[model samples]
Target: MSNDVKRPSGRHHGDLRRVLEEAALELVAEGGPKACTLAEVSRRAGVSVAAPYKHFADRDSLLAALVQKGYAEQRDRYVAAMKRKVEPAEQLAAFARAYVEFAAEQRPMFELTFAAGLDKTKYPELLNAGAELFEVLREPARNLRNTEAGSRDLVLAVAAAAHGLAVFVLEGVLLNVSQAKDLAASSARAIV
Candidate 1:
């Protein structure tokens, strides 16, 4: 109802659900998950406040959808990054760098993706989407080690390292680094 609130740009007709999702993401991107409200999302999407109810039950449901979409996009980025390299080690490094860089670039969405109190049972799509990203990492990891147990362990280790780097960078613990990608590559190489 606030005329001053800006509507999200570049929306087109058809798929009102997608429009609402995009509007919600824009709100979250600008000011974290708490800033996203159904009213605000509907307003920004240029729909009546009641309209969002048709697509989502409430703000939490919308946030869950956003989390699901975020995981899918993040997985796509890792997959694309891996495709750019042919060697197994290079592909693993690419996945690490991509994971860290995505966290850096999409801070708000990144934070929301890992937000507390996320009930996966209520949102199985969120759970499944998140699991897919980890599955992508296992491919290169299997190449790094022969046995299934060894590859799974190596994948966990590599993923933990990359996630740690991302958290450190986002928290400003690694501000002096000249290039995050270089450090990520070096760290990944040490492991492989």
Candidate 2:
């Protein structure tokens, strides 16, 4: 055999891990969760088939990593989007809007992270990460609830409405972001 093997150079081990994760994410985006195999991700990342194993134990591990990463990213977006000098009500509205925008923009990741049927116990890190995003909402929700018992009901009610609206919008049932934003705002007002 000819000795012409080209090795990956110039990147650290962490970089390789990132590349593997990114490749897996892309595969999931293109072909759903079933298509994201370790061999496929290695080939897509231009590394040897064994390279992925060095970073991920198996396909399931890689998927778990992807789910965890998705949760972290979603949480970061919420934190960044809500860090402004706006009213808590406005922040809540923006939070709902951000959730829909994120789901629409990252459909594959969203599906993998939130879609039913995954075993959360097997991936507690992802579960906690995902819970943290909702936990961030709890503070604002509690504040709104404090306005009145009715206000509390309103807060939960609006959140449920906003979540349903987001799912509808992401699935193409709703067509307009501005309209959704307006509707979410109105729903929030009715809650508080």
Candidate of highest lDDT:
1
TM-score (all chains, Cα) for each model = 0.81, 0.78
Model 2 misplaced stretches (Cα beyond 4 Å): 1-14, 147-159, 175-182
Output candidate 2 Cα RMSD: 3.3
lDDT of each: 0.80, 0.73
- Write one digit per residue (lDDT tens) for candidate 2, span 1-192: 557864576233558998888888888888778777788888888878888878777787777887887888888887777776256776677677667777778877777776524677987887788668767766666665665554456556666777787778776888896777677766765665
Q: Model 2: what TM-score?
A: 0.78
In Å, residue 3's CA in model 1 sits off its true spot by 18
Q: How many backbone clashes does candidate 1 have?
A: 0
Candidate 1 residue runs with Cα over 4 Å from true position: 1-15, 176-178
Cα error, residue 83 of model 1, in Å, equals 1.8
